[model samples]
Target: MIGVIGIIISLFLLMYLAYRGWSVILIAPVLACLAASFAIFDGGSFHMLATYTEKFMPALAGYIKAYFPMFLLGAVFGKVMDVSGSANAIAEFITTKIGKGKEIWAVVLSCAVITYGGVSLFVAAFAIYPIGAALFREADIPKRILPPAIALGAFTFTMTAIPGTPQIQNAIPMTFFGTDAFAAPILGIVAALIMLFGGMFWLTHVEKKAKAAGEGYGDHKNENLQIMDPQYLPSFVTSITPIIVVIVANFAFSKWILPSFDSSYLETDYDTSFKAVSGTWSLILALILGVALVILFNYKRFDKGVVECLKDGVQGSFLAVMNTASEVGYGNVIKTLAGFSLVAAGMLSISDNPLIGEAISSSVLAGITGSASGGLSIALATFSEQFIARASELGISPEVLHRVASVACGGLDTLPHNGAVITLLNVTGMTHKECYGNIGMCTVVIPAISCVAIIILGSMGIV
Candidate 1:
């Protein structure tokens, strides 16, 4: 249909322009209007301005209302960790424990530890890059490998496949599936292992090939960001405690504490059920506790002043959340179109197995949007009801569905235009041409393989 062509054309333009580095916040609304413009020819009452105001704006506002707390708290938590030196200390300790002559492994593990501990992916990269670059340079490894090494740790398994991870990508699924963060624990572990080891093996092989050809760390100037001052940083114990606090607090709250709260009056008092909000509540409280502990442990070490640190984080949170919300708004507009019905029907028909269709739909949308959280949010918003119904009819657990959908979005979402990928490249001062191949192997190809493996395992009732 002409409308489907228009939608596809709009999507192509979105990706193309985004790949050229235009801001999605600037383009998403414009593209939403473009996609909706075709509806006028379909013999329907479609007002472009009305759709933007009524449908798109409401969807955007709703996402902000529901998720702004997590985004704000997460950015603040990551910021405090950075300013107080906790993130640097943790990365240093990890790299030190991994020892000398294995710089790539050290960088990967250092990044993995901090990001899995709930540090934002961007913060993890900024915190670990100086250390990783130093290690790679000392070990005579190619500097270009550093970004991919960091990407392997920060962007793949820890962000998606790991159980109990507090990343927003993982948290987004909880509300949709009415499942907690630790969904499909056994299957999550399997996928995590596949991405971690599989990625490491590829990196190791790349290292060996480069060494055989005598490729050494090339000369490159350090980025202008503030370098970590070891003298003022807290000890490893003080630095790591906050991360542990977040992990333990998240687990206890999600598993025990929040559930014990009396919400029986919700039918009369609040419109929502307890299960609908418990997962988000757990992460929010855990992040708050983590931020409080980070300050408590390093109260005097905030070189930028606590107010300034908080301001920077608050600013960052607004930008990050707005970008994703705009994409969600674009999706909301797309869903209202006549063409989207065809796309949804095709997605649902991908497999008799709901898991396969779920995986493919989430991954493709994520790839199209070039954002994991945005695409995952949109997919769940659009197809969650169908997935839930199909899954229930087929005897599939919602927990498995949660795990699959979470991991599925992560793979294609890291394509070159991804915000995180661009930030990683900028942090390391590396070009996509110089290192994106490695990044693709680690974050994209490997994660996809892991996702496929988990899909098979889920289909086999292994979850």
Candidate 2:
């Protein structure tokens, strides 16, 4: 009971600090240390610390190994795309295709393509902002529309809407359900369609209404808004090479490399095999591909630009990557205290209702972590096994619960301090007042619709 209290208190404190504008990476470890100290002083021991270190260190290391390379590779690719002018080339192509009168639709489609193509959310914001802003200026659309439209178009759907996306949020539940990406394709597709249509309709309505009221993101006229030159264009194929490499590598590793490695001498289960292949090797290959593209595409004219770009990319990525790493480390600390697990057990013990159980778990963790991915990770880590057991007992397909958890992961997860959201805000030079409506639309509205769809589908055994 005391342990559960410690967990709740720690979670609430973390959330408060996050709401107060502390980064999750900083807040998590500090809170974890505080939780550990409280547990220790309350009769836990140094042995408890040691146990936590043993368990969490490996998980943290694994997470770093798995994700860091992707970040580096992505950063390098984005930098290359920026310098080589592929982004502009693609933006131009999109603009030409959409023609002059439909700038809003062009912005939406551009964001969707870049996001679904696996660009980092921050990079997507920065890359698309100038284009969207320029487009809005030319089309007489309000500047206020650009931020939310870009955000919704880039983040809401494709993060989980497309099956086989390799999104961490989607992948986390697979750790427990033992299901593949295809397991809930129908659900993902349905959710994606709903988000896509809803986002487009809302943005269009807001634009027209704002225009009618003569109130739009405070008029700022600039002469360069309509220019769409391709003098600096780089090859489109070269620009997208890294995304292709990562996706293909992920698929190949899942299908062949890991299976062969496991079958030969290891004989591990699917999950273990997945972890092995999806971690260090996959990322290393991705980094190599990114580097190769930099060399092949720009080495002659740019000379040392590739090396400089690599350094800058890695350096720029550190804060965000470390933030995620620290969150993982904190989660490790919580696991060490067994505080989160105790809360889960207690919730189950008190209420046999799965809906109530899910609500209790998601609300606490989501509220605390201020990250959909982080909060859902905590919930899934704590309740996955129990959820499976309950599903099995009730003759429900465990896949349904797994899908429910996956869809639920997106709800209200973005903390004011979330690195991605903060990065987006910083890049766009927009405040919460200017942008929170859109974030709320994606993080709250879309997820609510998704949850309803999940419940309906899950209950019918269709997920």
Q: RMSDs, each prediction?
A: 1.4, 4.3
Over 4 Å off, model 2: 1-9, 19-23, 36-59, 179-183, 220-229, 237-262, 268-271, 274-304, 335-367, 392-403
Q: After superposition, how far is residue 407 of candidate 2 from its true place, in Å?
A: 3.2
Q: After superposition, how far is residue 5 of candidate 2 from its true place, in Å?
A: 5.9
Candidate 1, 172-213: lDDT as tens digits: 998899888888999999999999899889999999999999
Task: Give the TM-score of each candidate.
Answer: 0.97, 0.80
Enumerate residue pairs that collide in model 2. 372-413
Full-model lDDT for every candidate: 0.89, 0.63
Residue-level lDDT tens digits of model 2 in 1-463: 4666776787788767766677766567657766776666567664445544665556567566656665666566666655555555666678668988688778777777665555556666777778877777667777766767776766667665565554555555555676644346677778777877877777788877888898755655442343335665665666566556656665565555755663433334433544333434544564466556646775654535667766776786676566666666677677667566665577677666453465456544654566655666667666777777777776667556655666665666654555566666766666778777867776567766876776666666676
Error of 1 at 427 (Å): 1.6
lDDT of 2: 0.63
Model 1 root mean square deviation, Cα atoms: 1.4
